[model samples]
Target: MKAGRKVWSVLMLTLIIAVIAAGCGGGNGKNTGGNAQPGNSAGTTKTSTKDNKDVVIAVNANFITLDPHNASDTNSISGARTMYEGLLGFDENMGLSPALATEYKISDDGLTYTFTLREGVKFHDGTDFNSEAVAINIARIQDEKNNLRLRKSFAKVAKVETPDAKTVVFTLTEPYNAFLNKVAMAGMISPKALEEKGENIVKEPVGTGAFKFKEWVQGDRLVVVKNEEYWQVGVPKVDSVTFRPVPENGSRIAMLKTSEADFIYPMPTEQVSEVEGVEGIKINKVDSTIVRYVTLNTTKKPYDDLKVRQAINYAINKEAYIKVVKSGLGKKLDSTMSSKTQHYSQQNGYDFDLEKAKSLLAEAGYPNGFEAEIWGENDSETIKGMQFISQQLAQVGIKVEVKSMEGGTLSDMINSAKTPEEAKIQMWYVSWSPSSGDADGATRGLFSSEMWPPAGANTAYYKNENVDKWIAEANKSIDPKVAKDIYANIQKTIWEDAPWAFMGVDQIVSGSRDYLNGVKVYPDGSINIRQAEVK
Candidate 1:
């Protein structure tokens, strides 16, 4: 066991040094120069005679589910976005805007929302989209038996009314300032399809987006065909799109280089230099709202002690993590939410201080530190991240065992525990993006006590009465200033409590062939292919 531990330690140290060296070396003088523009920017790649309408995007993971209302992971959400859209949608900057809904208004009391549906819209299955359709979709999500993943976002809805074919009214039991953002995330599905498919909607999806589901060969690829009869005339320039899950970083990059795939998300930051100046390829780097962190299971031993949690936070070097893990393509996270998140407030964060960490360990009654395990997904980047964390924590006498598991297995492991004491997790290295683009979206599902596992994403089992109260107040406050203040306080308190070893905010990076155009990646890392075209 000691020998194995030594070998693992050596490997982690070597990886950290190599990554730091790569970052220091900088982008290999090769200009990533091309007609490449931001995903949302106006431009097109060089035209090709070949059928450019058929595009393939190589993603790092398989789609968890196609049902937008139940999907949680980003990959699944991206798949849902290809063929499903909500009454509202997010722009490149993650700002809410109209999509299926032409216009909407919220009452002064914050209990009512009235929306005017777009006229003459039709679902992929040829069902007419009207106020009743919207009402049906909303009811399906709010239904308790269905067990939708985002039901909490609409739990307060008291009633749904369709006054006319074009107008829908929503009456809330109480104020919810984040309702608009939540609506933007609740992608609309065909009412008829829902009735026919029932729980099978996750596999066979039908929506009113620019694309329609074609085929899904689980673990292989999922395909979507263009909705030629789409509501938006002349849009959805692509004929078909195929999403392949290539979990290996090198393979995904190779697919981009060989034209086997037109695009690849989360282009390995370490390989940005290798792909730069490569023919028929371009890279898109944009500021992102995605934040990565190590969740310290506050209910576990050692971590149960406040001083130990704070010590772990101080032991990690955020700047070094950015340099090594992300190749300097990210910023050190100072708050729970990324700076790109709406109403985010920066707070003072723990700096790397080995002496301070040691002192805290002693105070926590662990002068020699304690042994613990760190969990993460079995992806290349996630493994590296876990190793780096293990190496960093070791510096402060904390012996960390790294366990990387498959995505689904990890989810089951984290959620299987019925109570905090039963949870086997000691720490988990993970990433989160508040795709809803609201402060409540960032806080409520993550920091709120009510969002514990089996219910929400608060896997850390972290709870604080003051923080919980603040989150509640912030979610209901219609005033922006009040919400901002409450969020600021939340950040400050959480940072001090150190429930997580806040890592860094990723700079969303994706690569594609010059022929692929009109594809935009939101700050939350979900790709928007509404206007995607292979030119």
Candidate 2:
């Protein structure tokens, strides 16, 4: 019998900135710990002093790395809160807004991008913003040793040239329609700083952001002081920003409840209502691109069979999983592409049916059900979610052994599971978010055959000639609509194959005291610290 297909795919087909001061010469500062009163509409924090008192911004995880060219994790991106600047930033409405580049123009050929630097911008270490700085920063990212995180996205750039002191031009080997959006990454560091710090600089960042880096004690806290000399006058109202790494969900919420911290970004969903009931605490919820999904090792056993893959997809009850695991903070996913994204197709991917799954299992010669290993990050929610799936799969005779480990370790296990001999785990839970709006932003790193196990991020070992062909054609297509349609097809095709059992999209929650102001959250989960203020 031909299976009823969802519109989504399931087949076996394939596919900134300037300088100001010279050194770390600033005033003495004190850390005032407690609940901060809300700031006025101007986005300021009342408890913060205009002078030397530092405002702290706490996080659950420490940064993975600070190199804009090399870092890929959210922690590293979030670390940009105080350390880097990009040419464009997301505004309160989640639209693109200017940052370092005052104005930019694309050549008639659409093969070159020219950016005119805004005057008076300076690096935290006091280097002037000019053509030389721009030239060097681009070159550093192009350098192979740096292993910049998003390097493949820039493979089309022919060269970076500075025509004048304030003007920089990026000549592309081929016209890249997504180039502008790709440059929205906050990891763009200053060339001067890179030359000075070499490989050691990420630990000590210097950028033209609202806050200035002061000190980072690994696994504990990263502190930043106010940038009084910041170009945008009256901006970054807070005296300073600090990121404290407290991994436990309960403790992180407790820190906010006890007034130990002024603001807690992304409060655990399970603890949301409890925190909201507390007076003086506000829970701001918004839709986001952060998604948690299960990636099957397509090249490995059990999963290699399309029916088995489909069986796995049909066996689990996603609605129940979301209700319990997400704790009311998720939206079901219909495709690998985020629902919040513009190009997403509304077609459904999979709907739960245990009987059909069992029949598919019997057809695949697993009538008795087979045993498989599943992996997820050690986080409380992730482990619990996987355990739930284990129980659901058991109803169909598939025994799932759940393994929990740190994210880095889990990543290693998935990466190493490429070859049949080396395959240890058959399935794993993974989450992803696009660095920017472009389709290339999500697919280039995760789907490309270029990224093999251990070396690149292709964890599923998923590859298809058709997907690759579509990607290549889309890359060459200059027309935005044409490219979008092709990528949309790619999303549909990927969904049909079931390489990943689409899971859920998460909501990014920010819990701030009434006093802290200027906190705007992006669907991508990035915070615009520059636009925030402390009263």
Lowest lDDT 10-residue stretch of candidate 1: 33-42
In candidate 2 the C-alpha lDDT for residue 275 amounts to: 53
Each candidate's lDDT (Cα)? 0.83, 0.69
Give per-candidate clash totals. 0, 31
lDDT of 2 by residue, 1-535 (tens): 2354432112211000001011111111121222333222212223322233355555655566666666666666767645677777656544566888888999877888988887898888888867788677777777677666567767788988888887888899877777777776644566677787877777888888877888877766777777877888887777767777655555555556545666776676766765564556778888887777787878788888889988888887677667666766887877777777656765574687777899999999999899988887654456666777777788789998988775556656655555645866667786777757667766756676676565456667688788888888877778878998988888877878777777788888878765666766677776656655545
| TM match of model 1 to true structure | 0.91
Global CA lDDT computed for model 1: 0.83
